[model samples]
Target: MEALGGLPEEAVVNSHVLQFYFHQALAAYRAGRNRDFRQFRDVMQALLVRPLEKDHIMARRLRLMQFLSRVEEGENLDCTFDKESDLTPLESAIGVLELIHTEFAVTQETMETLREMVKEAAVIVCIRNREFEKAAEIVKRHIGKEPKSQVSLCWNERQLLEHCLVCPMGCWGTEVPGVVSGMSYRVGSMTPEGVRGFLEKHAH
Candidate 1:
């Protein structure tokens, strides 16, 4: 923290800076520096409004911070989707990002759904980016945002093996799924059944 403090203020103000601010605020909270925590927290919230920020893959995440800040302050949201964004509430949640202070009977229930959806979305983005530490950090910070279920996925040989790189820390389990599945064929690739037989012979 002291080393970071020695750098110019602009040093931490970059496209992917919120994670740093989030940690700084966390450190402040741990140190019992309420004012410093709030200051960093507020700065994180304010950064969401930058036009450049709105274009990134993590746009939803930046807005997510804004809503989280408001929620921390005990404010309620009537909507969660960005006013300027074309995505619907469902889309925003699916996109794992920003919406209105962000929530409404069925409408109200849907807000909770949105939160959960985005929680998973945030996890996916972290995992897809191979940010395992960040994934754990976020889950610890927002218990409600933790993934509700383990994920099961299937891919071609290349896709399946590549995900291993995403989990350098290693995971608890890996297994073949308990259902039959099939793949489609490209013009020149092996027949689907032939590929299946090949996989059976070379099965891991």
Candidate 2:
């Protein structure tokens, strides 16, 4: 907390407040609790995005301003996830993971209303500890007809050491196991129609 001006870089701890709030947001969205979801989204979005900005005005904060600015003008997710050399593996992982998690939290409710918006957006909900199974079950319930797969990201000391050797940046070390293509961010940025198609194709 001392480093980034009283806030952790990502602020997405495994069982922290953000995690709890995220689960709440997802629950609200799935239960069609739009009013609650919006309120929660607004608050959580503010906290989550406050520390992510490169620069901001004091006494007032802008959350997801970059995305908002882009969206207002009909731009897409054009930001690049370049490898930053300075940050340690843990730091980089936390930042990137939190970004993805926050993105999902803010959009989950809206995505429910317009599942097509996330049709091409691949839902990669990482499950570590018991929470993983719970999250997986929830996603399965929501994505009812689609085929879903689970990959383990839990590693012991030795395995982690080995993985770190290979993936030094720790961008996506052995902890996260899955078919990761170096192409898209998540779900490969499919259009709304494409998202629908992905679900349809996977439904069996």
Candidate 3:
């Protein structure tokens, strides 16, 4: 297969040849060969331009490999991708999650790792599109099973929603009372009557 790398561009664009490289890439990734995996990844990226189909296993695998490669390269999976393509990263990740659930009968640990990667990709896509509330929900639903300390991100859903509500301009550090402190402090800081009076006074 190494010899194929020297072939001319026209020859490499054949779907059969691209599929061969896709399988090779998948094998290298699964075998934990980082160098070989990257070599084949570049080949697929260069030659494969067809849209992915969810029901096609090889196509799905190639798309998964491409997504993971972007992630491994520290590229944002959220903002990139052809807008006219059939699947966005978020949609592709969801399809991958469904495939993992129904098609493969893997163990719990392996299942969790696959699910986390797809969910993380989805959340990052939401965040990049300025869908903070949706992103927070995705994080909570898919990735927030562990305790707060075990969760990777520093902020929780409430914190994220609060930031989205109050900081439209994206200045996160500015101090505001109820908004910053969150709803947990609402009862402690103001009585029912006081809250009503405050709202009435501000009503216009």
The candidate that wins on lDDT is 3
Task: Highest TM-score: give the candidate number.
Answer: 3
lDDT at 95, model 1: 38
TM-score of each: 0.27, 0.24, 0.41
lDDT of each: 0.40, 0.34, 0.49
Candidate 3 residue 85 C-alpha distance from true site, Å: 10
Candidate 3's TM-score: 0.41
Tell me the tens digit of each residue's lDDT in model 1 across 1-204: 222546444433553576677667645544546568669977876765652223433444454444333323211123344577533233344333233323201144444544553443343334444444554444444433334343222343224223334543535244412111232212112112422232233222
Error of 1 at 153 (Å): 38
Compose the digit string of candidate 3's lDDT tens values, residues 23-107.
Answer: 6765664455667878988877776565322245554555456444543432233443445753444545455446545644445
By summed lDDT, the worst window of 10 consecutive residues in model 2 runs over 67-76
Model 2 clash tally?
5
**What lDDT is reached at residue 56 by model 1?**
37
Error of 2 at 139 (Å): 29
For residue 178, give model 1's deviation from the true position in Å.
Answer: 57
